[model samples]
Target chain A: MLIRRPPDLLPSEITPEPLARGRRALLKGLGAGAALAGLGLPQISQAGSLGTLRPSPLSSDEKLTPLKSVTGYNNFYEFGTDKEDPARHAPGRLKTQPWTVTVEGEIKRPRTFSIDDLLKLAPLEERIYRMRCVEGWSMVIPWVGFPLAELIRQVEPNGQARFVEFVTLADPQQMPGVRSPLLDWPYVEGLRLDEAQHPLTLLAVGLYGEVLPAQNGAPIRLVVPWKYGFKSAKSIVRIRFVREQPRSTWMKAGPSEYGFYSNVNPAVDHPRWSQATERRIGEFIKRKTLPFNGYADQVAGLYSGMDLRRFF
Target chain B: MTFQPTPRQLTAIKAALFLLTLLPALHYAHGLWSDSLGANPIEALTRGMGIWTLNFLFLTLCVSPLRKLSGWHWLLRLRRMLGLTAFAYGCLHLLTYLWLDQFWDVDAIARDIWKRPFITVGATAFLLMLPLALTSSHAAIRSLGGKRWQSLHRAVYAVAILGVVHYLWLVKRVALLDPIIYALVLAILLGWRVVERIRLNGPWPTRSTPPAVQPVVFMKRDAAAALGVPKKR
Candidate 1:
């Protein structure tokens, strides 16, 4: 109910008014044509409507991971710990429709915006980014969302706001992990202000030309392509700006194994296994992991002169 | 209505267990053939094999104590079969990690075994199992002699313990259910052995057995030791 209306779209926002309206009209025409042309195809998500965001200059041409693989296999520990647990258990278990993200702490405007407000507030973009898990597996995902920088810019972080922290929902009725003490509940994740503002940083709302699957962090999730997948917190409910570095779940759980930055570095191995190579989804042999996950040219300067292994 | 199975029946029982032990491997093979491993098949394959290795180790440990309590001497025969199957699974587990997961990256694997505690413990357990697996032969048993061979095989308890530690430490966030369940089962199995030992030896002090009673206890101890060492010749 709260995620369908864009009543708060300000005139000064990023997307120009005329262009936005024009695109909507084009999408409508395409949807109508699609329905009329074939077996009256009902699904028109791929009609460059719900998913077509701005084309990211930073994305790759690599083959996109299949939607089924992307949605069916996940590590949203809230549903359960297993990769398939979310797919099997999360369909009707969690409520995503009336989701709201509370933006607060050291910001000029600290307001709670419903999912609809988020969609209207920021212009979406499609980015085919590499997602590498800390457990040595990789996938190429086509994400649809606006830049996290735009969201941070809208909130207007004060100078004291140094780190951006995100918190996920912790409801036992929906999340089984909340009942189990496997992790400190209300899973928290963070990034430095600079990293949060990076152009590649995304606040994803959809994937594969469709709305985000409940299993894959529906409604809202953060996506930092350069870092391990865990750093990109899913099912985000709150974004708080703070002066000090925020406490992240994995880093809090095992500091030695999971560092705050969590940058994808083959040189620095996890405590239990090597991170030098990653098994891509559907591929048998592992491929060599890249520096900054192959976006070194863009992101390396952000950590200039800092020791990655030490920070990691 | 006797629990004793004839030699032919014993052979049939061993055959059934051997097939049962292959089920995990066969299931993994089917998964591989059908492309059902989902996303990272290698990770699935490696993890599955490693878990089965731990399972077989626990199953092998379970046999002795269960046999002791059940009063089924025939269960003793399945011990070697179970132990060897554990070793086979262990070998496959290591090979999967080495050949498929690491892609024969010997240097990296060497560094991993040396540096990582989980890998180190796992490698140690596998190495300990290796000597027992190698010596599982009629000629080796005959040459090593009963007392020495029995002493050598006693290393199995340590192997099972180390195997559990390796698995427990491997998980990132301590997947409690599997590890805790495994620990409980292992604790019970090993507890049985400990209780049986104290029952025969009496509490710590050696408690000065009466001169006449000592001979009878020594006879029981000798027979038990002999029972542990399988005859080869």
Candidate 2:
């Protein structure tokens, strides 16, 4: 059963309460009863009505400092190279009003679903993951979304779905990066079938109990925390399952510099510099990089028999 | 027997100056190893060290031009120190590329330098800096003698051109702004030499003198306007 708040109270419930005693006791009593309605986690449920997935409990922050926050804001070079460019350029162009994703390719259910239908397909969950960038800085973001494999599974990929490729919206009017000849328009990223099924990969739609800001890849974006930031492409429009490796944008720019896998292995250095160390975001000094970006325990099994050096 | 220092106390003073000149270059290296570089440290370190290397190379080139045009013979004394400082920073730049970037893999480093156009230009600049650095000592000057030493050191001219080329090639597209500014500054420094050479060979032709003098006078007139003055005829 999902909990459904009364329409009037829903809007006010998300705010911090000043009238504590009366509202707190009443809200607590109502929350207990409301849990019977089968609604997702109430924290995000009260924030918006996007039919967000019911997220898992907030994860622990093992030994990291308290200074963790979004280390970087988006820098959309199409609008301009400035950090605030994406916020200004993204909102008006990527209107979610008529957003829909065509889930075709080799899937049992080949259907085009509206963005609303997609959100309702699964219970939203939140996961705090460390994001490392190829440029040698990192961030810890508590993102709200569910596993991407959950969505892929619902479509029921065919036996030949060895790879899953994500294609971002290509309208030059919307994504200004498409204007420049720097890359093939409509950025694409892919993961091997098993890699896509990894429990850690997230399909993020919101952060901080609010709808994801336009600059933050609103509606939907992939979050593969262990890899460098570029691997998680933004503003996705299509998903294609294929047999061969898809050409990645950064790798196309400089193959020697950016590899296909791009897993954060400190030992395999980039052509221009070593990946052995990275500056923790918001901190002054760079720390030694850990194997698989410190999530080796969880992801190490996936690469058990293969050589990271060759893949990297 | 050694060629003893001229009454200039050349040995002690030159050594002290050499060590002092190394401080700024050393400070950059310290920042690199300690990771004091801000966000995007790779770029910060790359650009920071790269710009300093070019500046030192430019400063080295300036010595001969300033000596010739300004008739400041004493400026010649600092040429070796300035050239060596350029070499030191060049070495640090390459070291960052080696240890930090290639993880000290000689084969991989060699391949990249050979294959990439920008890296090729940068590597040529470093290789050219090598002999210049080796020949910076008084012993090297004595062994080569004055004429040979001057000819070998003329390689600094080649180094300057290569440094600018490397910078231009690294950036995407032509990006004429930065390279153009550096080119203009270098051309002015080189132009001063050309002017000094023509002046020494013969007096400036009357025709060229009139046109050249007009721009200088016009610049002064513009300056005079700021000072609330109409120049007297």
Candidate 3:
């Protein structure tokens, strides 16, 4: 789909001729010290004293430890079986500074918005979310971003828009993980009409305070915290509002293991394991997966009256 | 290429080889209990155990080839145990995916096996390993008789190939090194068998050759139940 780029920003990060990508903009506007310091919180907690005596501030409600930290720190298994693979390998390759998301499919304005345009459209807010993976593990990330609905409204959805399909960048040349055959590259994810419209869903651009690390889907990505991590498709390149149910990458790969809803519920057990419990990242010693990833009040209503066992 | 292997030495070697196959799975379980499994430990554990199971399957397939080509008859005794151990690790690999990855989500798991090619192949390999494991016991072997038992265990060859295909396709990219090594090992094992088949001309002959009209030993359907493998497809 053709996309109308915002008044500012280039179409792609890479240019034949030498030109600055977001380095100057990010450093000058955001402040390198502030950005680095913001990213340092996790590292400090990860490296510093991790024992029963000293728990992470992130785990205000739960007993936290290093095993719990593991769930949060290293999660992208598609990149490598190692937990730290995504973080260690993702940063430089994912050029986020010059990123723009192409919004198309059943929209009043089939346009592309620059990172700056997104920030100007709506102010950023931090939501402490508990992210549960389909693999029975969980993590709480204090994500800073804007509501997904706000962006959807800006595009002006057409009447036919019944679902939102999110596509991740699939550049094996840039993303080493894409080079692996673990999954179909450029991981795809989607949400139903109502679910996409839900207030809890976020079109996250940053974490801590700075723009999201490239490893964390830099620039912008979907964040359905209460659902499995796969629901939060990283490095979003396309945002399509479709009439039919979009085929999700993981669901298509293994439909039995991944459902359309993918809500975080202990009742539904993946054939190989029980979803009844989850090891909360950072709260390794004291982590216990809660209903709706401990955000029951915010998201439990969405799945009301539905049988999780069947959907799961 | 043929050499002599005694029944007594074969029995002992088979028992030891079986124990060796359990090491990887036992290591994984120990890691899980010791909290040594890395973050997202299940993936590593699952992948490790799965690859090991496939490795053992290839190793088991090589026994006859090694015996014939290397002229080491002792290899034959290790075949059954090696095959059984492969099945054991295969079971653990499947369990890890079910309990750790899918969380007992039967519908999701079933859908994955049906929809995903890798999962389908993996689940099939595991299922194929089950009959091999069940029939590894001496009692089942005795009941099935030698010829029938050998024929039943031949499923290991298919299971090994399927296991490799499952691993190869699971990667988003080819993951060139690991899968290639596995393929190479499997190729060498199978290749040796091909050579042995050519050398022997056909199935190996025993000390006793039947007279002009020897009574053929056929496995009765009821008795076939005792063998490890399902009656030939």
Candidate 4:
């Protein structure tokens, strides 16, 4: 199962790591200039154009998965169930233009922000996060977005807002898979108010220095680094601040298999499969899955004194 | 419309069918070598092999119904080859899981077989195919006698059912359409056989007496003669 690495170019021809980093910095500066220039103009097409992203120190130094695999392989059932279905069907089928995300319910200032307005809410940062799927596969993706906390601050949720629920777009005309009754439609995911405000939890607008592809939940999506990939709802249209714990789509579909709190703990085996180890996409050997997907130091406190197995 | 081929032509057809069955294996090998099996090549290979095994099983089951409906007796001559191809793919699927997935970890493999319902069902299906594969030979068939051999090979129905259930249980509940289609095809194939049986013998098997007519037995002899094989005299 080992794939041979392509023959390396001559050492003299290769750019050093620091120089490459400097070049990326230069590019970011130029991108910022371009972004400012395009501010007055109408919104750019969703395929490309994410403007500028301020690089974050929080990004993982581990090798990023190839953009091909990141964009190609997806589990957005709104497109279809097959891994490749999203990539194949989502591009043309999904219309992200003139999109507006309504943030309401248990919030003081209920606002419906256009995609453009949402992008400008906070400074976007590049966070290289380890995304682990429940189906024994993992990927390290350089996601470009701002923290979810930024939006929460803007809306100012009331004390009754104990939980946050994310609802994604489900249009049958746009999403063909919506025609099939696969789980409850308009995929829903929720997080505790504290978990939503965590620095690591992001509302991703793009990846790999480009606008988020339609398959990867174009325009905007939630990115919960410590949880299983499904926790991150895609193509979001509504964000609700609720009091009771919201039941996620997977949780509703299979209560025993998928729990509301799907934190990536290697010890917690899925009812149908083991999660102790995960195949890291391109690599042949399975790597040991870490507690909280190696973000235990940052997120372990959120679940302290709670039985993860029971919650899961 | 029926046409009988010469023994040489039949051999050529059999050879062609054998090569056709190898295409799926070759496609996967090419996918592996070219590094085009998406993100997880091992999973792609494993699942592909398992699917082909089910496909061949479906083909094997279709033979009798096809021969009966179309009056093409020679189709039965290809059934054993189809069954064996299904078995071959089943073996490869198991090997992929053992070597690539489990890394030959006996402890993990044993635990999986014992704990996971899908894995247990899949393993049982493969194990049951072993006896049918062993007794597929002409000599083994002669030693066991036609009635006993047929009864033993009837285990294929069970194997097919288990294989479908294994697949259904393996996938996420949302992705049940593919496995359900396999289940439907199997049901129709088995249902055809049941209807044929009812037509041959009354709906109820009253122990009063056996039916005077045995067209199925005669058809097998006719198929053997068509394929230029000596009858069981």
lDDT of each: 0.79, 0.66, 0.65, 0.84
DockQ of all predictions against the true structure, Cα-based: 0.50, 0.07, 0.11, 0.59
lDDT of 1 by residue, A240-265 (tens): 99999997988778888899899999
lDDT by residue for model 2 over A202-290, one digit each (tens)?
A: 88776543455567776777888778888887767788887778888666776777777889988887655557677675455567787
* Candidate RMSDs in order: 8.4, 14.1, 12.0, 7.0
| Ranked candidates (DockQ, high to low) | 4, 1, 3, 2
* Two-way lDDT contest, 1 vs 2, winner: 1
Model 1: per-residue lDDT, tens digit, B1-233?
33989999999999999899999999999999998987667778888888888788888888887777778889978888888988998899999988998888889899989988989989888877877888878778788886678666767777777788888888866366787788788788777776776787776356675421232244344334434544444
| Collision count for each candidate, in order | 0, 13, 32, 0
Task: Sort by lDDT, best first.
Answer: 4, 1, 2, 3
Clashing pairs in 1: none
Off by over 4 Å in 3: A1-32, A35-60, A63-84, A105-111, A158-160, A177-185, A208-211, A254-257, A266-296, A303-312, B1-36, B72-233
Off by over 4 Å in 1: A1-51, B207-233
List the lowest-lDDT window of 10 residues for candidate 3 chain B.
B210-219
TM-score of 3: 0.62
| Model 4 root-mean-square deviation | 7.0
lDDT digits (tens) for residues B1-233 of candidate 4: 58788999999999999999999999999999999998788999999999999999999999999998889899999999999999999999999999999899899889889989999999988887887887789998998788767756767877888899999999997799999999899888887887887787776457366432343443344333333432344
Model 3, A1-312: lDDT tens per residue?
011123454344222121123222333454434444444331111212101111112222222223224223654544554566677777666676666788999999999987667766665555546677776566645455677888888888989999999987887677766666657766888898678877788877655434566666766778886788878988788889999998898777778778888877777666555576676542333245577776687667777897877876
User: Between candidates 1 and 4, which one is better according to DockQ?
Assistant: 4
